[model samples]
Target: MKILHVVDMISQQRGGGSAKVPYQLGEAQARLGHKVTIYASDFHAEDQLPPKGVELKKFHCALNLLGGVRITPSMVFADFSQFDIVHLHNYRTLVNIIAANKGRPYIVQALGSCLPINGLTIPLHNFIWRNLILKRASALIAIAEMEIGQYVAEGADSKRISLIPAGIKCNEFNRRPARVKDGKKRVLFLGRFHEDKSPVLLAKAIKILNRNDVILLMAGYDDGCEKTMRRQIKELGIEDKVDYIGARYGKDKADTYAMADIYIMPSRREVFGLTLLEALACGTPVIATDRCGVASLLPPECGLVVPFDEYALAKAINEALDKDIASSYREYRIKWAKQYDWSKIAPKIIEVYRKVLGT
Candidate 1:
């Protein structure tokens, strides 16, 4: 089957969860003998193309002068009839809206943009999605059931909507037996340093816990929010307890996970966090928020799930540290993460492609 995956950008570093999902799925599908072509923006030279087996098409996501307002190209005005399935990623720009109206079998994978944060854009995007795309779509894939509910509320056909959780490459996050070290309980927060990530909350939780032996490793680019987080740490008087290692990915990410005793994600909202899976696959127990879709993967035996409150998070952290259940929980984490491996999940996507194209 010929599949066209449309997204705004394809760089792994753009720090958008949506970009990772489609790229992972597209690559896996291509590996499985499907013809996959990705349409992404050339924002960074490093993000110009995808890996082998998938053809990457470049497009400019720059601004056009329409009375000095920055706007994306209209998708409703593009030609999109070449593929059997048009899977739109984070291409929620004007170009996608134009392309959606094109006569093709459409499927939208909502990463996390459809939440209330978009305000009036939700209604407007929905109007175009429902009346223009969803009404004519072959299917719509929602990463979480919560997202599926949102799509249904916007009048999307329930039959056409599938709650398909994003799959991680298990080998990329597999347990390393030799790297475990016994030391102070380390709480790691490895993600974008954004307001939604709520890095300050994790810092505040560490401050409240007041565990001198517990260290906080905040790894990722601050993107200018580091100063605010530093102020919070200073106000809480835990500056000495936190270490900021800016922006580590790939092997550095794996090594950090290898050393950590616990993985913490205090995100206020997460559709499905890939890092959560990465942590679990590394045999590291997690203490994630109830709002995170990744928390669904956490059984009581594996880790703790708490509300976004600092006290609640701190309490969970203490409980995890005090129990010394690392070995047992690590075993459970590895077993649990293996079930969601892309090696297993990719087949379902291939089946979806075949079903959509009737090949």
Candidate 2:
């Protein structure tokens, strides 16, 4: 099978997870003896090319000022008929509009953008997705079942939707021995710092818990919410308690995972918290909000789920650090993480490809 993978920008600049998915899938599909070509933007440097049987096609795109996501121009839309199947990953910008207008049968791997509450750009995005993209899709792949509801609400055809969770390369984030807290436990928040991500709320919750023995390690780039979060941290007098580690990727990201005692994500909205899966696979117990799509897949014993409230989040955090909580649940999370590796995910994705391509 010859497959063309499309997206807005396929660089590390957009962060790791989305970029990693296509690269990993391309590699796997190529290994299984299929041809794969990735279409990405030059603005986002290529992290890794498709494997032996795959190809890379780079195009130029115009950058959207506010979101920083790129738009694919009409010129890039030519030559859509070359591939057996066109698979799109996170190509929700004008790039998707171009692809849809090309009038080719395509599969949309909708990551999370279709959710209304996830962005303020909903009105315009709705127009683009409804009028331009979803209607043209042969299949709309959702990361999780919980994530499919939003698409359904948007009037997407039920039969066209398929739920497939994002795959984690387990070996990269192999299970580590549970860290026993000595003095201060290291808590990691790995994702862009934004209101939706709720880093400020996490800081406040930690302060309310008054767990001086726990040091909050905030990782990832500040996505326009640094000043607001910094102010909140300062007001709560948690300036000393919180350490911002900025953005990390590659082995640095894995090492950051290795150093943490627990993973905390207090995000208010999540289609599928890919970081949640990454942390669990690293053998770190997770504490997250009810809204996380991955939360349902969490082994009941691996972590605790709470409401998005500060108090509930704080309680879950405190519990996650408890010796009893860690001891009783550690193995369960490790076992659960082992089940959804990239190796397992690869074949499933191929099956979807075959289905969409009618092969």
Candidate 3:
């Protein structure tokens, strides 16, 4: 099968999970003997190229609007009919509209953008996108079951939607062995430093813990919230307790997950928290919000799932630290994450593709 993947950008440092998912899925598909080509605006240099097997066609973006939507002529002019299926990564983009107009059978992986969390205009945008564009697709890939209702509400046919969780390279994270109590516990918050990510809440939670022995590693790209986060940290006087390591990837990313005793994701409105999966895959327990789609996948013994509140988060963190479950649960966490491996997940996605293509 010849598959074409269209996304705005494909950079490890900038694109985050949205870029990584399609690239990884494309690689997985290629390993299954499918010819996959990813089309994106090449914002990164040659040093930051995508993985092998999946072909990448880079184009320059003429303009970027509304923070994420890119206007690329290359995408508009691309021959969509050349591929058996065109898979779109995100919606509300000019590229997606162009693809919709191209008369090819395409599939849309909403990537949490379909949820009407942004504002009134976004809901309207999504409603129109779903009714006019997405409804015509061969299928709509819902990363979480929670998102299926949102798609249905937006006028998508229920039967046209398929639930497929985003997958991770489980082996990439080097799982840690049972650790001896070193008197110091490390709490990690690894993702975009944004308001929606609720980094401020995590900082506040760390302050409430008031523990001298615990260190919080706040690492990720700044999404216009660094100043606010720094201000909050200073106001709360937890500067010494937190270290701001900007954007970690590859071995460094894996090592950070392995070293951490507990990983915290306090996102207020997350569609799916991929980092939570990575943390568990590395044998590190997680404290994620109930709002995140990843929370649904977690078992009670794996980690704590709390509401989106600073006090609740702080309490969960404190309780997680007090329990000596890390060593005992290390094997369980790794075993649980194995089911979400791309090797296992890709076959499910291939099944969806085959059904869509009627092959």
Candidate 4:
């Protein structure tokens, strides 16, 4: 099969998980002897090297209309008809709009953006999605069970929606990291320092916890909230308790997760907690909010699911380090992570593709 994967950008720092899903999935699919090409904007083209088998087609994005809705004017004239199947990595983007307008059947994996958020674009996005994208989509993929409802709310057909979790590269995290023993135990946060991710919430929670033994290692690319988070950190006087590392990727990301005593997903809303799985796979203690879609997939003995309250988050963090609430979870971390590896998960996606193609 000839597969075309579409995304807004092609780098981890620029596109986060959105860029990764396609590259990984396409690579895995290519290994199965299928031709895969990924279509994306040239956000950070020079830095990215897509995995061996996947072909990356990058078009120049001339304008950014805030919140990742960029205008790649050239993509308007580009062709997508040659592929046997098309996969869209995000919702409400020029790429998706073009795929819909092209009158070709495409599968949509919203990558957790199905919820009607992202201000100003909501109404317009709704109108376009409901009227066009949703109607034209052959299938809708849910990374978690909760995302199925999000697809329904977005006007996607229920029968067309399939639950498909994102795949992980297990081998990259196979090396166990030796933690540098300081006096303090560290809890790591790996994501963009954006308001949506609730960087300030974690800072406030760290302040509320007021612990001498635990340190919050905040690492990520800043998405405009670092200044505010830094201000609040200073105001709360928890500067010494928190360390701001820019971002971690490749082996560094694996090492960061492995070295941590605990990992946290403090996002106000996370449809699929990729970092949560990474941390769990690394055998790190973990905490997530109730709103995390991936939380449902984890067993009770694996992680703490608290509400979004700073106090509650702080309490969970305390329990994760002190009580060791996840003993059984640690025992099965590596084995469990292998279940969602691309090698296993990609075959299920191929089944979906086969069904869609009626072959």
Candidate 5:
């Protein structure tokens, strides 16, 4: 099968998990003896490259309308009819609209963007995309079962939706040494320092806990919220207790996870929590909000889930710090993470592809 994945950008710094899913899936499909190509805009060329066995084709972009939407005029000149299947990642982009108009049997990966939220242009955007574009796709892939209703409500046929969780490179993370809490326990929060990720809530949680022995390490690229977070940190007087380490990847990211005692994800909403899975694979206990899609897949022995409240998060952090479950649960966490390995997940995606192609 010849498969082409269409996304906004291919760089890890800009695309985050959207870029990763296609790279991993393409690699997995290539390993299965299928031809896979990833078509994306070359917005950030300095970031990490895709894995082996997956072909990457990048084009130049003309403009970026919204912060999230990419406008690549070059896509209009490209020929997409040769591929057996085209997979579109993320919606509300000119790239996706172009791909959808190519008259090929395509699939749309929602990436948690299907849900209706209070926004000025989002409702109108979704209505047009859902009715005119997405509803006609071969299939709509939902990363979590919780997202199926959102698609259905937006006029997608229920039978046309396939629930496939995003996968990770488990071996890279599982090979790391188990997290050790030798001196002051380190609590790590990794992801964009944006309002949606609830970074301010994390700072408030640290302030509420008021612990002298624990350190909070916040690592990620700033998505226009660093100033507000810093202001909150200073206002709460937890400046000394928190450390800001800008965006980590590769070995640095693995090392950061290995050094942490607990990984905290206080997101108000998440379609899928890739970092949480990475923490589990590294045998680092986690404290995540229940709103995260991956929280449902987490084993009880691996992590704790609480509501997105400062006090609730602080209490969960206190309990995780005081409990000595790391050594006992290390193997369990590693074992649970293996279920999400790309080697296992790829087959499920392949099955969906086969269904779409009727092969």
Candidate 6:
């Protein structure tokens, strides 16, 4: 099957699930003997290398509009019908709206963007796309069971929505043996340094913990909140405990995860915590907010699911790094993450596409 994946951008450093999901899914789909082509903006395109068996078509961003929507006028002239089916990632984008009306049976994996977010330009974007895209979509990919109602509320038929979780390549992360490392208990927060990801909250949690031995390895691309987080870290007098390591990829990311005693994701709202899987795949114990879709899948033996609160996150971090559970979690998490491997999840996605095409 020939598949077209339409996404806002293919830049992994953009530090959003939508940015990474399309390429990773496309890579996996291509690996399964399907031809996959990706259409996205050239934003940080150099930072990403498309996986083998995938073709990437990058269009120049003609206009950066309200809400950072990269308007690619070239999409208007591009051929979207050549593919057997199309998959749209990240809702509320101008390119997605254009591609949705291109007469191809395209499914939407909104990546939690379908939730009624009343952002600056979301209403206008939704108003333009509601009929052309969501209503006319072949299927809606819901990453979390919690997102089913969100799609239904957006005037989608529940039957047209398929619950599919994002997958990780277990081989991408090098699994470290469960051994005791002599160093400060490193707690990693390795995603967007943005408010939605709650990096500031994690900083506060670190401040609240007031621990001398534990260090916060705050890493990733700055999504407009690094200054605020850095200031807060300084204001809270925890600068010595927090290290700001900018953007890690490939081997660096896997080693970063493996080096940490605990990985914490304190997202206020999340569809699926992909980093949780990445961290777990590296045999790193994780703590994510209950809002994450992956939080439910993690057992107490390997991970901890906490609420979006500093005290709760602080406690979870402490418990995750505890001597008794930490060693055991490191050993068990690698086994736990193997179940959601992309090799297994890609076939389920192909099933959705085949069903849409009546194959």
Q: Please provide TM-scores, in order, for all candidate models, with all chains considered together.
A: 0.90, 0.90, 0.94, 0.95, 0.95, 0.94
lDDT of 1 at 200: 91
Model 4 poorest 10 in a row by lDDT: 324-333
lDDT of 6 by residue, 1-359 (tens): 99999987888767367877887888899889999999888866755677689999888877776667788888888898789999999777888988898888999998888767666977675667787789899999898888888888888999999998888889988557443466678888998878888898898899888888898998898777888888888898999998888888888889888888888889998888889999999988888898887898888877788888999998877766666455775667888888888888899999999999999
Report the C-alpha lDDT of model 4 over 1-359, residue by residue, as the tens digit.
99999888888666788888998899999999999998888877655777788888888989877666788888888888898888888787778888777766689999888876677877877678777887578988889988899888877789999898998888887656466778677888899888889988888888888889978899998788888888989999999998988799888888998888778888888888888878877777678888888887777666788898999999888877787543345657777777888999999988888889898
Q: Which digits, one per residue and each the tens of the lDDT, describe model 5 over residues 144-262?
A: 97888788877889999988899988887864554554668788999898888999999999999998998999999888798999999999999999999988887788888878888
Q: How far off is residue 188 in model 4, in Å? A: 0.8
Candidate 1 wrongly placed segments (more than 4 Å): 45-49, 64-79, 117-126, 175-182
Q: Which pairs of residues have clashing backbones in candidate 5?
A: none
Q: Which residue pairs overlap in candidate 3's backbone?
A: none
Please give the distance, in angstroms, between residue 39's alpha carbon in candidate 4 and its true position after superposition: 0.7
lDDT of 3: 0.84
Please report how far candidate 4 places residue 14 from its true position, in Å: 2.1
In model 1, what is the error at residue 333, expressed in angstroms?
Answer: 1.3
**Candidate 4 global lDDT:** 0.83
Candidate topping lDDT: 5
Q: Give the worst 10-residue stretch by lDDT in candidate 6.
A: 174-183
Query: Alpha-carbon error at 172 in model 5, in Å?
Result: 1.1
lDDT of 1 at 29: 86
Give the Å shift of residue 16 in candidate 6.
2.6
lDDT of 2 by residue, 76-167 (tens): 64687877878888746666777767766788887777755457877886677776888778888888887678778777887988887887
Please give the CA lDDT of all the candidate structures.
0.75, 0.76, 0.84, 0.83, 0.85, 0.84
Across 134-231, the per-residue lDDT of candidate 1 in tens digits comes to 56767778777788777777677888877777888778777474333556778899988888889998998998899878889999886557788888
Write out the backbone clash pairs for model 6.
Answer: none
Indicate which candidate wins on TM-score: 5
* Poorly placed runs, candidate 2 (over 4 Å): 46-53, 74-78, 117-128, 175-182, 327-331
